[model samples]
Target: MKKNYFFSIVALLTVSLGSMQGQVVNGTFENIKDNGLISNWGMNFFTPITIDAETGETTQDFITFGCWPGFVFPSWDANHGQHAMQMTNGLNVTTNTIIPAKSILFNDPKQDIPGWNPGIPVDLSDQVAMLGFDYKFTRMGNDIAEAELVVFGTDGQELGRATVDISQTNTQYQYLYEPVQFTSFGIPASIQVSFSMAKEGSVPAFGSTLIVDDVIVSYAALANDEFQSTQFIVYPTVASSEINIVKGSTAPSGNYNFTITNMEGKTVSNQSIQLSDNNPFTVDVSQLSKGIYFISSKGFSTKFMKQ
Candidate 1:
């Protein structure tokens, strides 16, 4: 029995070997292949074309190719690491091979196998306020490079979408952010971020480039269950002297009895107080000991720390 338990522990550890704690995979564009290709990105294939039948000379043509633009590149101009995803919408007639560029790298790159999918899946069960990234764009003539951030539900429904139009040419990278509103299902289950060097049906100009690095996802500090209605905000989550409970946005106004308990399941205190949806309520915790505690009133229950 002990030997079976030991193997169970080892199996659990092996399963969690490379799991990330937050956000998408490889957001820094640092993970690369031995051939210098970026990891977690969807890849396309390009076969050499024979231009001269006798000499076997080859060339590339934009007349027939994938919309992924130029092969995804890794540039030394990394924001916080050794490399960043450098995507360019340029054309070269050199004798070489090209492939489709994969965008929307997830937090987990190992799932990016089989070479092609609309996007790599991601887990966004955490409440995220917005998605942000650093980028620099260079377009010629009327061509523009755009970045798209999309969130999807388990049923394959698009929950929320944020789009940024990149038309101006920026030599220096700039910080940009987009808000991700939650759905009725609490948090989304998957996400895919794609980029376009030019709009549909339009061709990209030569030498156009878009470099991105360090995808940052800012999460709402509150737990999901605490603010499902965007009301009943409790402040000083780590209670010091007292705790503040504010009711906002159609919050119920009333007097309710409440109880506080310690981690040992001991009922520390019980009391009743009047509260208004507009006015804030203050609770005195000067007597409670410094530890973890749970507060329950009406139908809502939340946990906080006391110190």
Candidate 2:
């Protein structure tokens, strides 16, 4: 995978990591250093900047092929704040290979993954229910982007996590809310949040970009019976012309609102349908492009693929 190569090369080089508590630091990518890099986040490569002894002028060099500095950068095109983090798949001039651009939250210098520190210490004294953020993604081709949030216990055990797939193109920013489901009870000691323009095993396509901003953690817990009462499922996880929305036995018969969104978090369809007893609601999805999409309603949601 491309990410494996990223860490292997980084093992030979040294870089700095950021730290914070209760929340993510520089979540908006507003705190930038004089070198035009986001403060706290580490870089995969660095360029030597020289200063003139007499003129006191400075000169910094950039790679001829890829964007300056690195794949992940701060951009004025923001969703909420003054800036946002932009990542793109580009050529690594040093290695002469195409790699995905990514940003990970890291704080522990003692904890290292071969050569990279990938998560930051987080005090989850107050339990969180969901993690959300605003993003705009432009997938060049078959490339897939991803955003992930992971929670770890004090013993370094995996407690919970949520993942959002970025498989569709969206020029406009959209919000994604993902619920975190824990596997065991423990005090969360750290958290890892990451955004990547391309994932491993994907065809690294150039010009594919993901712009992200305002990473937030929700404290309000999701209702235990939120979707259980009106449980439903989408048939033919992989679909073509149409799909069925099957309601659970406990679900009540009435008019229900339905919303369909592409992988980019863009809403493609929304309508209200009257469902009767023991009947499945058929939705026409033939018009949708070949890709993954989500069907969501008041308190229930699931995904399907349009082929």
lDDT of 1 by residue, 66-97 (tens): 23333565679875557887776434445232
Candidate 1: worst 10 consecutive residues by lDDT? 8-17
Q: Over 4 Å off in model 1, which ranges? A: 1-22, 45-70, 92-102, 106-114, 181-187, 219-307
**Which candidate leads the pack in TM-score?**
2
* Model 2 per-residue lDDT tens digits across residues 34-131: 55666555435434455666666665533332444457677899865578877776564554566667776555333222125566676555455457
Candidates in order, TM-scores: namely: 0.52, 0.57
Which 10-residue window of candidate 2 scores lowest in summed lDDT?
A: 5-14
Report the Cα lDDT for residue 130, model 1: 58
